[model samples]
Target: MGLLKGIDPILTADLLWVLRAMGHGDRLAIVDCNFPAAQVAKSTVTGKDPIILTVPLPQAVSAICELLPLDYFEESSVFYMAPQDGVAMPPEGNAVIDELKSAIATVSSPDVSIAPVERFQFYEEAKKCFAIVQTLERRPYGNAILVKGVIGPDGKDLKPN
Candidate 1:
């Protein structure tokens, strides 16, 4: 069966609320299986309830990107988890990047670049984001973070298409 028109079921009500509530420059983090989600989203910390979407990383990340305009002002709006402890980006990370690129293409977004953040730094960043999506992807380094951009008065993207 199909979802309601223009409504993606992959984006749950909680996720949608978080997206809608976020203003421009707000960041959203989509984390892999290995990341610490609950620990970071503590009410004692950011005072915002944690949002977890139990889908695969690529789907969650792409769907989110499709709905939310990315921050074009930044040098890199999307960030992936960099290799840590002398390891490099795993095969899965590459696949996730390909998936994200395809999503950016599907949306006709002008900026398709994704930056890398060290493991601990990524976690710290995620802790401060508007929300975090905990995907079921078992692949190492499948995490990604996205910064939100603004929509213009003419109903066009503020960031170039």
Candidate 2:
């Protein structure tokens, strides 16, 4: 299989699936260590990330984004979650941001906006994302949400018809 820079190989298959079905406005959540994924996955029983799970949130997001197209020009093409305190986010959060930049280097992802919300708001949104990829990172607020965008008719990443 092909690969993207900074992406870890463990979740490559799942990342590929993210690429195929998710469309603009569709979201992907990269959860931090304590997200209660085990409880979240109770319905499907997709076992939680094992204690031995490797890969950091940034690396996981990078891998998942690879499956996604970089053009997020639609109004809701891409969205991110940060703390509502509105304090300057920490550098760790930028990990995903950097990857997004790299992914969009050759495309347009204006819809790709990172919005800060209350921690609770993030949980609510995370529940509805196209899907969430739980990472092994133990850092707090390392979570992120990304909306999908489409390639424009003119060959740019814009909202789909």
Candidate 3:
């Protein structure tokens, strides 16, 4: 039997496959319900097929973070969609960002910081990711992008098991 801790029940098998298929430096976008995921995903630079999830924004992002190690090579591996109208981060946006930071800290380092990108720029960035998860979150700025990192070896026995 295979058992993995910290795996959220909302992570479906398709989502798991997407995670496993992603390599170091690959990016994953978790967007809100209003995001044009289907249109954007069709044109990513990644040659692989894109995966989209329709759960809540926070749940999808947190669940993905639980299993996906973040890429620390970049200054800020996480990015949020900024409002095109130059508005402030709403309470919901702040809550989602905080939740993502807390979740990333559990699996990786505590210094993970999320940057912001303009609305159109965010869509372009999403077009380069390996996959995009479209959540049911109706909030305007609930989108986020995560870069994947490599997992270390199982042990240092100096031989294969």
For 21-129, candidate 2 gives per-residue lDDT tens digits of 6766566666777786555433221233322236766666565555565444533444455666756666766665555445433234333555555677877777676
lDDT of 1 by residue, 109-149 (tens): 74556788988888888877877778887787888888888
Question: Whose lDDT is greatest here?
Answer: 1
- Show how many residue pairs clash in every candidate, following the order shown: 0, 3, 0
Better of 1 and 2 by TM-score: 1
Cα-lDDT of candidate 3:
0.76
Model 3 TM-score on a 0 to 1 scale: 0.80
Rank the models by lDDT, top first.
1, 3, 2
- Please rank every candidate by TM-score, starting with the best: 1, 3, 2
Native-to-model Cα distance after best TM-score fit, residue 40 in candidate 3, in Å: 0.6
- Report RMSD (Å) for each prediction in the order shown: 2.7, 5.1, 5.0
lDDT of 3 by residue, 1-161 (tens): 25467677778776798888888789888888888888887876544444556676777877787788777667788888876775777888777767666766665567776788888899999998887777888777888999886665852111212
**Candidate 3 segments exceeding 4 Å error:** 1-6, 45-54, 154-161
**Pairs of residues clashing in candidate 1:** none
TM-score of predicted structure 2: 0.63
